[model samples]
Target: MNTISYRWMTSLVFVLFAGLLGAWSAADASELPALNITQVSENVFSAIGATAAPSRDNFGHNNNLSFVITEGGVVVVNGGDNVLLAAALHRAIEERTDKPVRYVINENGQGHAFLGNSYWSDLGVTIIAQREAIEEIKAHGEASLSQMRARMGPVVTDARVVVPDVAVDDHYVLELASEPIELRRFGAAHSPGDLSVWLPKQRILIAGDIAFHERLLGIFPDSDVDAWIDSFDVMASLNPVVVIPGHGHPTDIETLRYFTQGYLQFLRDEIEVILDDDGGLSDAYEIDQSAYESLDTFDELARKNAGRLFRQMEEKLFQ
Candidate 1:
């Protein structure tokens, strides 16, 4: 088999094995919530998180937590949403290899991305994030902790706001591993300081919140849809053979394009039509998002996303 097909089949086999093991795997003996781990490549693995909103059941694990085992050590992506989840992920890593976790890279400053830094920080793991992400964490980390506490209660009692040890501007090449991992921030995306972890040698991209496959991408108050499209285009230019997204299972670039950029463009196009016709925000909300109705979180975010984009477009038009 070709190299690409071999890697894909290997990953598929691991996924099927994980599925057969069920949601709560052997890691449950550690008394922590077990993540569904999927092998992406030879040394790369990802713990797929729940697609639903953060809650007591999922322990605020609403985003993917991934890791790469390298000759130097293991590098983790997304500290997880809280201490327990991070600890749980660590336990799973231990089960795989004996390499110590050398670094934890936060994809962004969002709670699900960096809140678990408390766990890694306590262990003296070097943490890394984009400069803007560090600033976002410094400014809003406490608020994110409070929100997780409210949603998860005692589960997040040990969770605290912890910033990264290293902050890079737009690009940072992490070389501790045999296969150097490149962390790059294209621009404004799903959230501030969003970045993707690119394994050039493997042609696999761990796209943080920049790409969403199974779920509907959220448009936050600060999100710039226009810039997001531009950023997605830049990231897509890499032609990744495999894509591990922030909130879904390991997928391909085409799937991300269909669900993320395609969805955003569809909403923006619909909103532009409404604005040109002198329609109101309510009309924007009623735009046909049925095509995306099958996606996770569509019920919770579809109309809200449309309304937010409408306001954003309207503000830009008047500006």
Candidate 2:
């Protein structure tokens, strides 16, 4: 670990927290400041959505994040870049219970999922995540944080990126907080491997990137759109009543299919547009964004699902 300047850290925290207690905006709705957390159901908790992504924070919707306060301890799903959000979550957990958080879970390998891991790991909390997430962080965490320092700021880089203490090869079902928890690994969709934290006791599903509320899901360098669409079916299989998305607000099982259909269809349309335009791959990407900006933010995820969607479109066109 590299040593950081304390003065820089203090200044950075202040700059990053300027809006911590302010009003909300749709864009700012993506942050997980402690104030956002709300006890939605019995023993089920989440940091409500906030507007804007933080200066150093990379992912847009670490928002709508949550933790499960089991009788034994609290289990945090996504750590939100690092300790600031993680500590905020820890504060929220304290409000609901005196139980120590025994487990930290990641729904996906995104920075939002694993970056804040140091907080729990330091406290001897067992970190749980998919095999792929562990590998990705090990491969890229440091470099990513270094590059993101300016935008997301110094605290993110100051915090150590952690790997999963427990790696699941396939789906794993276990008990936590005296409740039956289903850690379902539904193949590759949003990333190499995605885990859906299911609380059978509460009938709540933490549907990471598998579903989003009124926003375009990001299909990154590792994402598979078709497989991502299929993952939605997997999310639906549980027939969850209340869902905690990786971003935005809570949603239901019904919206998963609705959003998936729109996402998949939009990809198909872009593929057709790319072929008809007879343009190069890059051109198709640009064209798709201009044409589809009106679709939905989910369609505009990373502002470049357009390119990924276009690449998939081009592949299908050639095939």
lDDT of 1 by residue, 9-112 (tens): 53464345334434324333356887899999889999999999988888888889999998878899999987778878987897898677889999998999
lDDT of 2 by residue, 192-231 (tens): 7687788877789887777765555667777787777766
TM-score of 1: 0.90
Best by TM-score: 1
True-structure RMSD for candidate 2 = 8.0
The C-alpha stretches of model 2 lying farther than 4 A from their native spots are 1-33, 56-61, 152-157, 276-303, 316-319
**Each model's lDDT:** 0.86, 0.66
- RMSD (CA, angstroms), candidate 1: 8.4
lDDT at residue 20 of model 2 (Cα atoms): 48
- Lowest summed lDDT across 10 adjacent residues in model 1 is found at 20-29
